[model samples]
Target chain A: RKLESGDAAEARDNFAGFKLIKVLNENTRNKCIFVHGSFEGSDDDAVVLMEKTPFDKQSISAMLTSTTDLKQVMQNDIYGVYTSSPPPDLNGINTTIIYPATDRHIMKYSAQQIYLINETAEEYQEITLPFIESQPFSLQWVYNILDKKAESDRIIFEDEDTDTGFILLPDMKWDEKLTENLYIIGICHKRGIRSLRDLGREHLPLLNNIAKKGKEAICTKYGVKENQLRVYLHYQPSYYHLHVHFTHVNFDAPGMNIGKAHLLLDVMENIEMQSDYYPKKTFTFTAKEKDPLYLKYKAAGKM
Target chain B: RKLESGDAAEARDNFAGFKLIKVLNENTRNKCIFVHGSFEGSDDDAVVLMEKTPFDKQSISAMLTSTTDLKQVMQNDIYGVYTSSPPPDLNGINTTIIYPATDRHIMKYSAQQIYLINETAEEYQEITLPFIESQPFSLQWVYNILDKKAESDRIIFEDEDTDTGFILLPDMKWDEKLTENLYIIGICHKRGIRSLRDLGREHLPLLNNIAKKGKEAICTKYGVKENQLRVYLHYQPSYYHLHVHFTHVNFDAPGMNIGKAHLLLDVMENIEMQSDYYPKKTFTFTAKEKDPLYLKYKAAGKM
Candidate 1:
């Protein structure tokens, strides 16, 4: 089927112009229809015209004015309707046809194009976050959600008091806060140890052995397929600390899925619970305990 | 001193010759040294002769000689040192010379140039292996060291008593003959109740938790700083199993000396001792436990 310039030109000349054009194939029986619309001169006079057509004997007929008109032709029982264009507005007949409306086709194609672009962008974001966080090395960091939430409040308490407020939580309450599917993996830089220089030189063999054994146990327990997991080590200079992170969301995987982020969080949570690699203690955050401290700020009108 | 190559009338005879020379310094050290070399020959020959003199000011004086004695000097240092020309007995003088012979300055420079070219190539092989192995999707097959060593003998035994011999000692021992420092992280693909897939899926969380706790425990136990410890994972695909490896090798950290391959083995051994996630079992591999049916083959040197 051909989309001739003449048909377009003819539509441009008339008002409620070219209603519908149908294309049909007689042999294999394929069909398509085109409808035109425009808002050239005044917006109110602009009209949209549609055509429902079928291809027969390798040619398409003039536009079918309505669904009923198209259905009437179907009584002959030929091929199916191949394509249809939107109907024209009967009310507007004086506006000059600016262009035959291909907005529907363009809109459909554009939507699909946009979806593909957005999908790739989202995947890129998911993959990049873990990598950036673990930068220079790819180590996962575990932060307690509750602790982060509390810290966000911007209360300046003494170190000991801060520990009491957050770290020294009751064990039962801590367990209660944990969900069934959630797990925690802790990253801690313990105080009072020599630098990495001393440890790697003197104790690398033993340290390496621990990491190896830990990895095997985790993999065996998780039911992850081979080559499906990635682990990175990142050194955070701010805390003068180094930590390692094990990740399941491999950026190199075929398609990045946001679901993998949730999976990584679950893995981190699990790691935190099973190992004593990080210290866990109970802490309380009572308003009464902190109110006296808040009153000092209130007196300064800073609360 | 400038290279005066226009024309020279030496000893009242018109002779085409050029003086190759250099000036040491402009003010404090205004010393001109005559570069004695043959100029009656082609540019290539001139270059060869000029190159024989060390460019260093400290050694240039020691290399200078009279231009008239070029043939004799060339005969002494250049002839027969590197090439055989005009027969070996021509005037009993050598025609070829080793360029940097006895010149420490030239020798050191040549050695440095050679080292720079070779160093990068050598490092490529050493550095790239770990990076490739660390890639998330890299596939590595794990074979029991013992299994590989006894492959030939096992094949022969299988031919004799196919079923009984194979089932009796299905698991191979670690190959001790291979001198490489290597260890196996045993990954079994169990089916039915606890399949390999199930184990892998469950293993990640378990291992993550173990790592979290283990890191703290190790820090406390060893009295090492928390930042000194690190964990990494690599998936071995040959086993068609999923496993996480926790390794403490910090390539960028100061003072890490273990080889990559050996470090991986050390990790496996550590996992065996430290990890609580795996279901531990003891198995014997004594010679006496060998199937009785294979005794005949053992005697025949087939097992």
Candidate 2:
């Protein structure tokens, strides 16, 4: 919202009137620049954010395959820093940029942490289950989608089978570019099942149907093959509703990292072999310091 | 080795004669800048690489808490880009640099893929197991270490309990700096077990011992608590020799991502519950395009 408002203002009047005050924070890990600033005639303080968006596959491929005029800014043997600008479309705000920089360049530029949480089945029941039940979150939107009261046009595929069906839709974060970073989600039709911990052998049919149909839909509509997809479920999911994520395997997606992602195939097999595998297995996930689950773990001395 | 050779040369000559020719590749994913060039007086072809290093915790904390002069290079409402350099030590080769640059800035400036391989138990037996068996790789180096004929001085901790014994050492990639990125490896003294696929309930004692003692050694020596440590093993490891990685949770270490890393605790639990769990279970791992495993998968039409 802040960015949109900023965009509107900048569109009307080029940032000639904007003035900088001081640096608020620099999140180098996420490549976000935030600063305290204000308009020339305004007394109200404003916060400005400049974030680096992820590169799509097409742009990178073009660069690697095509010839570009490269200007080396500095050189130290095999180590050199250079600045280059692609045609306007490929370049963002910073026309002159230096990259393929080291981890040190990014981290030293300021900072960054995510903690891995190992939650036993008993702990899940005692701590996480209770926390989810007690926490107030609105799932009305999910219900609306399931009931075809909202986002019906956005649905990529849907099987209305009451016992074994789900609605597949593009995740809000997806730009629908059909690139390697493509992402979509399949939200199950059946309610009451809340996250991976709630699944069992009885839910295998539903899981299998979703996995099969979801891949087919993507392949048919987006031209992405099944092999190029990463089908997974998140343990300690952000929302209570059971949903499956279908992403391009090439996408370095956040939250899809280890300690969080459980492959759908593995889950299906685990359940197929053992009825209560999901409920009984110890799932290791990540919890940030600000997470309530982290606080709960701290309270239980589990950390 | 190239980096070390450059360091040695620069230590004496101060990179004064270095000259740039052109950029070869810009790997934004790894933050490495590679180029083609030669010395000031020579026509000999040369290659140079500039990489941004990972930041240490102390340096970032000091920056966030300290006062720094503000200089704005450009501003556009909620977006602005500025360049500043930290004191010499905190800064690397680049004296002046921009912070919180965006993904667009990084990716558009260059380009990155890892593929997720879903190997069923049958596929593992038919393909991966045989491929690994046929690959000619030398474990003589590992043998030399276990025999106390190599890297003896670098051993951080060792337990000679025949069945559960292991030698712990700082990972070569670790700089021996006691920070959140601290990394160490525990290589089991017992031979024959090559990877996670070979583990069963019989090896629980060895795993548990490594998990426990490895934590104690780090806590005692580095003052890092067990909670701060992430102990895991790499699936489809760079090497077949079984070893456990001990890393501080704060470090965004490579190969620890979803498809590659398996928590030591989970592996132990899975094996404890079902002796042949790993042997029968499907595993999801990553493989690059050039990997032999990928080629094998291709031959089998698995991909």
Candidate 3:
């Protein structure tokens, strides 16, 4: 019996294109062979499946030994051909053939579109797409863009590709659950809304209250007064969400001093927000390993 | 004995016309009287001096007591009076007689002439004075004249009115006897000269050497490596002499960080040399605090 179908053709193409054949052959000693088949005893619309096995290899070897005209198909792109077989209880071979849709391709296309949307949204939030697209993505271009932006607006903070989901006002408070000594606060509103200004008269007060609460929590955790604590706010436009970030560093720790603390604070505050959407984010804060203050703060139980 | 004189009647008229009596009487409360005996010990000369003091005071005071008289004086409408008496020594006296010839007018005229000479000498180094009726005798004026000469030649570093003192470089190893961290090294010539280019070339090396030495000294004292030490040099133009000043801060110290250090170094290195005639004669270097690395080095005992 012979069976030919679009799903079978695709499975054959995919199997042929697979690059693990060398490893498979080396490991399995050419014992394995590729096979395309459809589900049996189902509706006659089952999709094809690709498989590799030793029996197919045996059959292929037997055919190779006996055949002459089929030499080319067995040489470079050799794959086993099989016809549907009935189950033991069936009277005849009952084969169900189904066409496989390009679901993976559809998924890949969707992912790409989502990524592009995210990138475009981020650029729009930063108001930099026009200028960024105007120049090549070179160091000089980046510097010029930054310089021009700096000239007009005072960027308070920025974070690129950071997980903003963890950036909640309540989470910003000092708590044992927060494994890291740092937290990011994202100020954002719905798209097309000026969240920062519209943060109503009550908005500032609410922010201030959050800051005050965070400060209190930090002070309580560190056993220090609010006055003793120093907070830095990073302003990032990438998040486009109106948010203020508060970070603290304790210099009284063993290796920590005001200088190192300040440096770390600066690093955290300067993180740039690069994502366009609200949730999916990536950002990093880097500092010297032996930052005297980090060690001091760690020793002081303040990290 | 009567002194022989030309035209006794004219002398009488001259004596009557004298304004000394009015001037002396008017100023007697604030001024002291001085009398000097003539060689012949003649009572007539003594009487003439006494009579003239009161007579001149009366005449001048009466005229000047009103605004109209003051305006007249401003207009230079009054005649100048001359007295034969010597100017009084005012050291111990509450009041003293002032001779017309020894008045402040003479000093003012001399100062004006000196100013003119200074202005002329600045353009042309060599200045010769023509014979003039009056000459300055005040020591203060003489100093001013010298200062003016120095300025014209561009040989003085008086940009800042700091204490003026020569920075002497003796042949000695930098030790405690010298300013703890202060020394001047001459780069071009072992001896200092009065030109900008020559001083820069010579002094720059010396400065570097001094800086190096300072670094070594600080490192040695603190048990740190020389390279780890930071030195700061503050150039003071008021002191035109070229000298290297050594202090604790590294080129990367807070205020003297890399950027500031480069800026200041550039300024010092590229300082414009004024005209050759104004050869700069003094330069000052002030030491600022040390850098953190040096401080660490000092603590580590590896300079």
Candidate 4:
């Protein structure tokens, strides 16, 4: 493969290249890297990442500071750059993921892809959403979470289709919760959907069910009403999967900032306008030094 | 007065001059400037600022950026610089404030004189408690607040002294608290206590009353237990007057951070050890735009 002088210029200024958009939609120990991108007009809808993708320091430095000519190696999808027939509206292409020289900045094979957030609005929107329907199962761990949804140890309740279920967490940590101050934090899972972006006009009943029946059950058992429970989700979750946090309204839990906590009811109404509303917005959040997601932004010089 | 040749040398390095310490304690719009300072060496326990003391921009800039030989203006107590015979330990000064000058940053004032915090252990030592006997009344708006506190029209409840009372806030807005989520955020005032710094072992009964009777009253009315309610005081309070915030454990209220919210019990215990505990401590808090407290720091070139 030979690199043309024009291709070098494209790499420098134009950045006319393609990257395999990986979906990191699992909130578990195992990271599910869906390394195949789904661009509208790319030659192939999906291109699997080569196990030996070139992401050496030199390549990363050049990608960040200098121009990249990945086109020569990109023809056969050699370095995670799929040489595609130029889209009709190349100028209108939002191929640039965060910054320039997208192909060259891949520090690791698993680093490529777009991360979608669903807290107060969205955190990132420049990158186009992948063709979600291409992969029928959007979020990882959903299969296992769904399988254990009906167990007495985990599931407190579930819907008719069992798309949504509530599970009590195992941890009985009470360092923050005083003996007199009872706390109950559980996870509300919506099967198949990756995050809040998946909820739309169809999921109205789901939130209503949590508000009405779920509150009744908790109140009946714990002798507390639905109003005593706080139901929300953290933006840029610890993992990418969508889940609601249920806790005593008195508990001052983390991720309750106005920007990070998305109330289930507000989320339901937000979905009423548009299910994919969250993926199309921008948001602000404090990323600490130890967060892996923060590291990605740091490596990319965005921090 | 003529300029001296050696004054430049003094201005270039030596910041050895006495200033009247002003207590910027109140968080209200009307900043009651308690013009006085108490350093280890300043003459008389403290020297009050003469009303006509010069604080012209030129003098302040010279004092801060250049050497100040106040002897020229020593004939009279001019420019808030009082000529007092030095006390022992003249050089042992810790006048440096924080960087970028956070508005919330409290400089060495009468407030600083009373700070007895052990930063490591988070313990407050003893200081001869100020005779709060000067004013029997506390809080500027006490009179008007008392007027509206007893009428059901606004008064939530009132104790016997009519001092520690609750008044319902006008706005019923609740983005976090839904319909059944009736939030009643009110000011629970204690008569004659200027701030948390004014508390001493003598006032332990007040805190105990809040923990016991106040909690009982709230729980009996709201149908919540002592554990379900949260009572706290903010260090560097929103206002100088001592007030407690009681909210549902479920509500994610502002000033609820550990750094700001001093739990009622912790404060009571801290008071049991030393009532002057808060004044002798260093605290961190966010300063938003338009906070008058921030302006004072900005005027001092701290920001």
Using TM-score as the measure, the top candidate is 2
In the range B259-278, model 1's lDDT, one tens digit per residue, is 11112222333343344322
lDDT tens per residue, model 4, B154-218: 44445544443444331222211121122343454545565676677776766676556666666
iRMSD values, candidates in order: 45.6, 11.8, 60.9, 32.3
Give stretches of model 3 more than 4 Å off.
A1-303, B1-205, B235-238, B250-303
Candidate 1 has an lDDT of: 0.23
For all candidates, state DockQ relative to the true structure. 0.01, 0.15, 0.00, 0.01
How much lDDT does candidate 4 score? 0.38
lDDT of 1 by residue, A69-176 (tens): 211111111111111221222111111122322332223212110000111223323432243344442121113222443222221111222111112111110111
Over the stretch B280-303, how does candidate 2's per-residue lDDT look in tens digits? Answer: 888888776656788899889888
RMSD of each: 37.3, 9.5, 47.3, 26.6
lDDT of 4 by residue, A1-303 (tens): 322222321112221233435432111111011233433333333222211111222222222111211121111100011111111111011111222213332333333222222222322431212322333544444445556643346445554345545554322443323422334444455545555655667767666776566666656666654444666666545544556666555554566544356566556654554565455434434444555555555564554
True contacts kept of each: 0.00, 0.14, 0.00, 0.00
For each model, chain A TM-score? 0.21, 0.67, 0.23, 0.47
Best by DockQ: 2
Model 4, residue A191: what's the lDDT? 49
Each candidate: what lDDT? 0.23, 0.66, 0.24, 0.38
- After superposition, which runs of candidate 4 have C-alpha atoms over 4 Å from their true positions? A1-145, A149-154, A164-189, A273-276, A299-301, B1-303
Sequence-dependent TM-score of model 4: 0.31
| Deviating ranges (above 4 Å) for candidate 1 | A1-231, A234-267, A271-303, B1-177, B183-197, B200-303
